[model samples]
Target: MPAAPLSILHVVRQFLPNRGGLEDFVANLAREQARLGHRVRVLTLDRLFSAPEMRLPARETLEGIDIERIPFFGSHRYPVAPSVFRHLGDADLVHVHAIDFFFDAFALARPIHRRPMVATTHGGFFHTNAHSRLKKLWFDGPTRMSVRAYEAIVACSDSDARLFQAIAPGTITVIQNGVDLDKFAGAAAPEPRRALLTIGRFARNKRLDRLLATMQALNAEGPDWRLRIVGVPSDITAAALTAEIDRMGLSGAVTLHTGLDAPAVRALIGQSSLFVSASEYEGFGIALIEALSAGLVPVAHPNDAFAWLKERHPLITLADFADADAAAGAIRGAYDRLARGEVTRGEDLSDYRWSGVAARYIAVYKAALAEAGHGVAATAA
Candidate 1:
């Protein structure tokens, strides 16, 4: 018999009104959980980091999930929000995203709330090479202790799994972030697309500068190639990105869009033939998979997550973004292959479907409840 529905409380620092890989992952997962008959509530901070002046609604329902925003102090890296405890009181299981303050706080509060807790390592703080020594020390000391409190630890990619597995070998599971395949499915034309598209938040590790350099190299090839960049702001500001674009002499050839609606994004995908990203790190490359779902050929930088992807999906083209000429050469080769009908679109990506990913989480939640003696199905096996 199917198990009774469970009440899920998701904890994340950034959410809707905040657009990025982590935010999108939580949104899509919560939506799917709601669809599967789970009562879902997300507890997040009140402000979007990009525009701190603009506050999100304190309480509201979005995409079928109940979300409540509480005030947070401290930096964006580790938001100190003790008030989240008030909201998560009703959840059967607390599912925390990222290894931040919430992950630690909820684990510490587990003894009081007496609810099973689980967390997803959304790339961790290893997104950049910043503070390598301190991060390693923290990972070994504090991160290890916090992880011991979780019923399950989901690593969004193989790379992440390997990292967490070293600390919490027994509890880690690899559930790659799911893509909304239907969102842009079959949006790309069969022939190679002429324009290139890149999407994500403007993090420094995204290496947008390297992408611009690649564009300059492409321009030297004498093709009238244009690039469109769509993303929200995080570590980098919009003004800074603009200055860099102008500095690269790409002001005339590049178009930048922020806060675009899904339809608008889909429209851009329909008009473009290629998708590219020079991201130095990613928990899992959701945008790249979304592009592949749209039937766009992807030229990705060889980050650990993207490298894991390239091994499974043979169509993905990996280029070393460290060198502009080399990256540009890869892009040019991808275009030529498309122009000659050497390859086709519509790659099969059923394995990364949300239904499968959400199902895994649902089972994980059930096992968590049973283990916590909350009276659900017994055995994770």
Candidate 2:
């Protein structure tokens, strides 16, 4: 029997212009599945702030995947969208992005669609230290309800899977986020730029403040290294961080680069000696994967995913976040080792490539459909 062609649907807040690991994964996987002959479509929120003039009508096609963006009212915190439920009825399977933001909206809309859904927790909202009760209430209440609605759950790391299970227990799959190897290859000769780079949104959980403190402490010790921070910027917070950087006299030593494309980021990684991430918690360190592919030794806090890989690959040097001085020393040591070629990069990164990641998603998609009692036969796309 020929395999059934899946009419898969992916729901998220945004797809293009704003690029995060989950968004990249969905977009890449959608394209690959489309190439494999499955009909895949993406439903997203057309947030005004991100794309003010984005007149994405009710329907459009992007790279063989159908793209639909409904205007949703909420930042990454509490989403309120009425139209999302109406759209869910049209797919054989639904793949949701981010649990905390879209969970309530999806839960409310689930009965209308009656389709089997799976969620990918993209981190940030759940793990961050709560400053207000409302944030906790919003997360805890909606997460419990959302888990019941989902037929299955997936996380980018084993730790993430555990976090997901805290809400709903089941067979949670660990599909690590992947990178485009072709986009990041070793330059002809990696020049000794002796620079450190960190990439991600300037969110509190990212613990960039700690990293800056580490850099300042390192400067005091001896190694005069430059630190480059890159990502999208929030104006008010950027001003505050800039003021602090100026106050610390780190304006010359630390450079903040914003809104860089993937190619640009890879080029920057190629020039840098080491990539440092002090994220208190991350679902999966896609930035580290990118850095590793570009020949930048990764220096991270003792994250579960980092520790899990540290046993096998010597490329990553894990450090304790509480000891800023020790973290700084580890960064310096890794930098020196990378400079002298004493720490050679090892590990087969092919499994984390987009193609491999897409194949894994295909396996999960098949499993979800199967569990939902949808019979899918093997057929060439």
Candidate 3:
């Protein structure tokens, strides 16, 4: 007989239609769990500032997963929803994303639920200066404490796992993030165009300003490629980016896009010759996987998250992000090789499909339940 489906609850700072890797990861994982005949629900903050134009119902179902948005009352983007604890009692297992901010509350509430709990630390801490030393000091204790509360901690990459191991030490599982292979793979041959592409949130950590500088250098050297930056830009970053483009006289060579759906994004990638990432860090490079699946040559900074990918496929160009001259040269060399048919797209990533990812999560969920001595719940007929 087939095993019973479990009740899985995911707690995160935010969810779709907030466009970020974490949001997308939770949405896809929840949807996949629901599709696998499990009772899946998402608990998240109800905030409008991020994507005000895309109004979402406070309580609704999407792609078969139940979503509940709790109004946040705290100032530092930390959510304070007492009702979240009340809802926790209904779940067979709870999976929290990220160790900072809102999830500290979830950790405190986990003992009351007495359900098997898992936490996926999406990235490392101590890499950014945006969080003041005092803020980091204040949250650091809770973050470590919360991580220790989990029965299992999922890390998206080796680097992410190492960071968590430094504090919580055990129960770390390295599960790299998955991409939708069908949505990205087997595109019609990319049309010849002097175009470069990068897709991510326009946050300071993404280091897009460095990418802009590289584009400026490349244009000056005569390759004359247009860079398409596809992401929602912050007001401050948008103003800065526009100013830099104008100051560098790259007005005609760069374009910004926001609010693109999946198909639109894939279409854009299919037309571009290269995909670039200048992120200071990543737990896993989902955008890089998407680029490889779409058969676009990828160039990125030498970050540890891409170490596994680089090992598996040696052709991915890694450059020193601190040196624009060197980074631009690497990108130009890759592009010229592509034009000359000397280099090809990276390896196939069909193994990272959502079906396989969901299966891995299900195994972890079953293990968590077994460890807690709870029988898996039956699936609805």
The digit string of per-residue lDDT tens for model 2 on 1-381 reads 126677878887767556666667788878877777777888877653434555566677765668887876655455566677667645788888876456656666667666777777776365566665765675467667767777677788777777667767776777877676666666312755558888876667778788888888888856577888887643225667788788888898888876688777776676687888888777777777767777777889887767766665678999875677998889878877766768766457887877677667777777777777775533433
Candidate 1 residue lDDT tens string, 1-381: 235677789989999867888888899999988777777889999998898888889998876678899998888888898898888766888999999999888878778888898899999889999889999998998899999888889999989999998889867888879988998888875556568999998889999999999999999967588899999988999889999999888998888899997888998888889999999999999999999999899999999999999998877999999998999999999999889888767778998898889888888887777777887732222
Task: Please rank every candidate by TM-score, starting with the best.
Answer: 1, 3, 2
**For candidate 2, what is the total of clashing residue pairs?**
4
The Cα local distance difference test for each model comes to 0.87, 0.72, 0.76
Global fold similarity of model 3 (TM-score):
0.91
Worst 10 residues of 2 by lDDT: 47-56
Candidate 1: C-alpha lDDT:
0.87
User: Could you give the C-alpha RMSD of every candidate to the true structure, in order shown?
Assistant: 1.8, 3.1, 2.8
Stretch of 10 with least lDDT, candidate 1: 372-381
Q: What's the TM-score of each model vs. the native?
A: 0.96, 0.88, 0.91
Off by over 4 Å in 2: 48-65, 131-142, 187-189, 221-223, 234-236, 377-381
Candidate 2's displacement at residue 254, Å, is 1.3
The runs of at least 3 residues in candidate 1 whose Cα sits more than 4 Å from the true structure, single-residue gaps closed, are: 1-3, 189-191, 377-381
lDDT of 3 by residue, 36-79 (tens): 77778898877744554454678877666688887656652444
lDDT of 3 at 55: 45
TM-score of 2: 0.88
